[model samples]
Target chain A: MQKNQSIEIGALLLEIGALLMSAGANTNRIRLTMRRIAKSYGYKAEYLITHRAIMLTLQNPNGDLAFNQVKQTYAQVPNFMMVSGISRLSWRIVDENLSVETVWQEIERLKLLPKYPRLIILATVALACAAFCRLGGGNFTEMLIVFLASFSGLFIKQELGKKKVNPYFGVFLASFITTMICGVIGIWYPFQHDNMAFVTSVLYLIPGIPLINSISDIMDGNSLNGIIRALNGVVISFAIASGLLIAILIFNAV
Target chain B: MDWIDFFEKWIWFGVAAIGFAILFNVPKRTLIPIFIMAALGGSVKLVLLHWGDSLVLGTLLGAVLIGFLSIYAAHFKHSPPFVFAIPAVIPMVPGSYAYYTMKGIIKLSNNSNTTDFVPLLNDTITNGFKTLFILMAIAIGVFAPMLLTRRDSAKQIKMPLLKQDKK
Candidate 1:
């Protein structure tokens, strides 16, 4: 293959890696899928994947020609559709001997995959948090409070994200809003399971994917990336805690 | 728990999973299987907890069930297991323990007297450890099968041979 062709393949592989990483895939999946796709194109690919960037090296079978490139990844978003789409696309490339151009087109198509509407996402997530409240032994009234609290909290978070606010601050602000709503209602209502609502209201902010992905990354021998992801989870959790604390202090002051 | 209570818990588990799956933007076709798998996992944990099992142990078993079932579900749905497994396990997060841990820490920082400080410290430690261990249990349990299998079920693609150049 020509040097330009190899460069194209390397760029495509890096794009795939960055997409998978940002889509909340474990490092192992990113490594395996990228390698598999490169092998299908008659090249050997090696990747140095970090939380914020992916560096890929593609070489011909004889090891004489090599192409290297680094791509900065987008912000981490837990879109499983993109993760699964790219995984399936890698397999199609291997199975059908898809050309580099074809694979690139497929990647472009996957990028355009439609997401769930924002309003639907907001309602479902709020309902989920309310279910969490119920599981924590909350009464119906507490569940209703949690539902409203989380809905508004998630709305604020989404709006903050759209405005390019720092994500950790977005989480902190969202949780603060959620806790304030729950706490104020609890103080007035004095229900049996008010504590349950308070506990479950901010749960929609739990960094579930990052926490799990960190462990899986560690278990898969990518400790560096795992540690980075784990730290990311810790910071988000700390932001949440800080938000709750401030809300509790305000309640105390009142 | 009675049969009615058990079913109620199961339905809530399913609903929670569906909510999270939507939040994560999983493919629409895979939602039902995710719901079933999540409900089963949550039920396993609930039954174990009711049977006097430790919370960490019950969570581990539940996550294991979700992890293994997710493998099958991934094969059936042609999607990654994480799609099914992650949302399914969200219902089991130790949210209350985490909340209490934070609350304890804040109180601990505020109290100046040794008498209040000691118990606050203890409560913080206990809740903090519980939160850490439960999260570890869930993560380890949900990914154990995939780790042991050493291959992602959904991405087990065959490798093609490198073409040989003619002399």
Candidate 2:
């Protein structure tokens, strides 16, 4: 009886960690996708994780829940990558009623694909072009510059993924490259309203920390956190603004 | 933009929906219903905006009405509320407007020589506040029911209903 209770408790902890990792997902889009994946594995209430925050859905008839560290450990590994297939692995553990530690060991035995950098680059470039077209009134030249900036960032993330560079530095380089492109546009075409469009479109890549944090705050019933997330969003907006303004100022000075 | 022109340009909503659908890997089959619902809501908003009425009131009404519609649609389709609710409302997302406001603020700062910062500041503040109000309006409409009813209804409500109630 005690053993089964332990397993249920372990699974609950795993769910909570997944909730936190998923709460700030790139957009609710990722969360939605995860729910679909979970559904394919016959896991209902996938969206419940977002609300319940923690739960024990799996229980053993013998009164022995499969509690062990392995299940939780396996769950965490996929946090950094696409989790579609992770649900499948999780289902295996659930169906077998295996110990959490055993599930982790089994997950290690399964072959997993490494994160592909080219896909990230392609997605970034495509989205950048789309955003530019949307915001800049289809100004071809502005679209070209935004594409180049996004491309440079993609290449940097690739290098970081390969362990040839640090990820934070990579993201900063990407940000600088993007900012520089926007700065040049501002200097060359000071009168056009399209520059605003160009900058706003690129802001999509700015991590959406505000929305995620806000939702997380609300889900946790923490009003302070929600307010903080909203403020954070504004601050980040200003920070991006400051970065762009400072760049243009330096350019004008030169 | 006029009514017909509104729908024509409202292609942006479709684009947003498709973009979100692809990013999230939602089933292609589910896209049409979501798109149509967003279009309906978006058209109402565009109409209200054209009438020179309060955009806040328009947004609030649009969100609440759309929220209710999404819940109904989810029931009819036998899908989760988050499924229909999230994508169906993409047209209402404040993404574009928020982008414009932030960009406006930055451009104002760039014009350091201009003494007209007051007007620019007004526009920025107005937009910033408007975006917040719009999102909160949507959340109030959507989350209020979900919160009031209690959390984790999928575990509690979905199964028994699915078993006993056949639509």
Candidate 3:
């Protein structure tokens, strides 16, 4: 392959790596998928993947560096569809010997795919948190309280995201709002297991993907990336806890 | 547990998984499989808990089952396993434990008297450790299959130029 062709492939690989990283894929999966795609195109791929960026180098058949590029990854959004879609695309490239242009087109299509409607997401998440309350021995009233709290919390989070607020701050605000709602309701209603509502209300904000990915990365020997992800999870959890603390302090004063 | 209670818990577990799956925007086709896997995992954990097993042990076993099921479902649906596995295990996350741990820490800091310090510190430590261990269990359990089956090393690819240059 020509040097220019190799350069294009390197760029594509970097793009894929960036997309996967932003979609909350672990470092192992991103590295494996990129390497597979590079191998399919008759080049060896080397990468330094971090929380904020991916630096990729493509080596030609002679073991010479054909291309090197670095791309910045945005904040992770946990889009499993994008992660799965790109993983499948890598397999298709190897199995079908797909052209670079076809691969590029497919990536674009995956990016453009529509997400689930926001209202459905909100309802289901609220219901899920309510179910969580039930599992924790909450009564029906507590479930209802949790449902409303999580729904409103999630709505605030979504709106904050649209406004391009920092994600940690958004989580903090969401947790604060959810806990306040639950706490105030508990004070008025005086029901059994009211604490269950407080416990489950802000749960919709738990950074599950990041925490899981952090551990997987660490176990897979991507210690640097793993630590970064772990720190990210810690900060988000702290944001959530801090929000809850403030709400508790207010309740204590009351 | 009674049959009615078991079924209620199972169904709720599935709903919770579906909620998170949608939140993550997993492919529509994978949602049903995700629901089943998550519900089954939750049932396993619940059953174990009812039998007097530790929460960490129950979570680890349940997550392992989910991890294995996720690999199969991913194969059938042609998606990455994490897409299914992560959401399936979300319901089991120790969110309440973490919350309690945090609350305990705050209370400890705000306490003005030394009389209650021991119990407060004890409560904080227990909750903090529970949160950490349960999280570790979940991560390891869900990752076991992939770690065992897949090699992370890159495959070697031969190019025509290499042969031509050799000739």
Scored by lDDT, model 3 comes in at 0.87
- By TM-score rank, best first, the candidates go 1, 3, 2
Tell me the tens digit of each residue's lDDT in model 2 across A43-135.
Answer: 432222332233324333344333334221221111222232343444444556555566555444433544334564356444534543553
Query: Which tens-of-lDDT digit does each residue in A203-242 have in candidate 3?
Result: 8999898889889999999999888888988899989988
Q: Superposing every Cα of model 3 onto the true structure, what RMSD results? A: 5.7
What does DockQ come to for candidate 2? 0.15
Stretches > 4 Å off in candidate 1: B112-120, B152-167
lDDT of 1 at B43: 92
Worst 10 residues of 3 chain A by lDDT: A190-199
- Per residue, candidate 2 scores C-alpha lDDT tens digits across B1-167 of 65565655466555444444443344344567666666666666767877857766666666566665655555555444445445445446565567657667766857776678878888888888887777766656554445545644332333323344432
Model 2 docking tier (incorrect/acceptable/medium/high): incorrect
> With candidate 1 superimposed using the best TM-score fit, by how many Å does residue A95's alpha carbon deviate from the native?
0.6
lDDT by residue for model 3 over B52-162, one digit each (tens)? 678999999999999888777765687887888999999999878887887788888779989999999998999999999999999999997866666442122222223
Error of 2 at B17 (Å): 3.5
Residue A202 of model 1: what lDDT?
92
Looking at model 3, the pairs that clash are none
Q: Show where candidate 2 strays beyond 4 Å.
A: A1-5, A8-20, A23-173, A182-191, A206-216, A223-239, A250-254, B1-4, B24-41, B61-80, B83-121, B141-151, B154-167
Between 2 and 3, whose DockQ is larger? 3
DockQ of each: 0.60, 0.15, 0.55
